[model samples]
Target: MTIERTEPATDAAERTMLEGWLDYHRNTLAWKCEGLSDEQLRTASVEPSELSLMGLVRHMAEVERGWFRKVLTNEDAPPIYYSDEDQDGEFHLTESDTYQEAFATWQAEIETARRNAARFALDDLSEGKHRRTGEQFNLRWIYTHMIEEYARHNGHADLIRERLDGSTGD
Candidate 1:
């Protein structure tokens, strides 16, 4: 599939601009992984790191579900890729992990995230509290954090892609 990413609008409403950049970073991740085989997707960035494009995809799936489904709506959303016993399960690749399943789950979570976020205004408070501090968060904070999450991970993806086949771009 062809992954297309648009530059976030320079002049737009806050919500529109936020979503645009969020999506741009989302597609940037996809673009970095484009045309690679399952083995490539599963390849780790370096020894002892266990960081792979596939891992990032799975990790983001968990992040989306955690923030949008659990935090935003207080739905009974559980971690799909991790557990209390293995918090970093998403970053650890098993032999059976595949690109198809990882991408499908991530995309599905993205859709759910969009739907959940649509139910609230940017100023709306989330139903869930912060796991670390017990602080409340607004939808606007979630959007900004999600964008930062994607942007940071996308940078890792750039290096991984470059290592995989020397392909690089912003």
Candidate 2:
């Protein structure tokens, strides 16, 4: 499943509009995680939920990998996050991994996603079919879906980070 991206947009305005939403979503999620201590970042709100600042960062790494690389780019690389295994890998409760490591992974994944997205014109229809559903979605639609998903999670991150510490937006 190779993703062949065609240049679909002929104008600058269209390109900027598409890029803006991607930028907006990335910033929103990062803003939610800003200014917290290691302890604060690791704290989950309560039992029965695995969400935490660190966990979100790890999960989003996998999210980026899934949508951009696997789905959009049609890469066969395994998704970054594992459900049955790698439990501690994302939540990362141990003192072994630093904030920098988790943050870096997210950054690198986003950059990879950005490069893949840039391969196409903003509205270009995707060349690869979705792996699971075999449905077709344009590059534009994928960007919009990512923005919506990240925005939703970022809201949850906002409340969690707030509780972790009084620190707020960047």
Candidate 3:
């Protein structure tokens, strides 16, 4: 994944540490999607691959909901993109959606995540019993993991976008 310097263009400016790393990541993620019209962004790498840019957008939104809202807040909220019957629904891309539809949903979810994250103290803890191990976890772990999760998938998305077009770089 390309990381564009969020630094000010001039050398005289004193740069703050962690300056726009998160914003850089967010913009870089969006930058990978630049210049692709609706149809191209929604295109899949291969038929039946269950990997599409649109799906990644939705999946990341779901992840933010899962970690920041449900897990971080320890709410009993049901999984946003999960299904007990078929676990892979989150991976399935909706080709029928217009560009406006996909992006609008994504924008809404991103806002929700940001709002929830803003509400928490830095040391917030999750109160739920684990689904597999039946243990409790602090929200700290969930937040760290969410950052890692987004970074990792953002790498995957970079490659996908590269394949779509020659415009590559943060």
Most accurate candidate by lDDT? 1
Off by over 4 Å in 2: 1-12, 83-93, 168-170
Which window of 10 residues has the lowest lDDT sum in candidate 2? 1-10
The regions of model 1 sitting more than 4 angstroms off are: none
Question: Candidate 3 — worst ten consecutive residues by lDDT sum?
Answer: 11-20
List the candidate numbers ranked by TM-score, top first. 1, 2, 3
Question: Which pairs of residues clash in candidate 3, taking residues 3 or more apart in a chain or in different chains?
Answer: 125-139, 126-139
Measured by TM-score, the strongest candidate is 1
Q: Which stretches of candidate 3 lie over 4 Å from their true place?
A: 1-20, 79-82
TM-score of candidate 3 to 2 decimals: 0.74
> What is the Å distance of residue 76 in model 2 from its true position?
1.6
lDDT of 3 by residue, 1-170 (tens): 34353743444322222223444555556666656777787777676686767667667767766665666566665655558985766566465765566556656766776676666555555645556776655645655566567677778778789888865653
Better of 2 and 3 by lDDT: 2
lDDT of each residue in 18-100, candidate 2, tens digit only: 66666766776666666666777778867867678788888888878877887777777675556557644566456665567
The superposed Cα distance between candidate 3 and the true structure at residue 32, in angstroms, equals 1.7
How much is 158 displaced in model 2, in angstroms? Answer: 1.0
TM-score of every prediction relative to native: 0.98, 0.80, 0.74
Cα-lDDT of candidate 3? 0.62
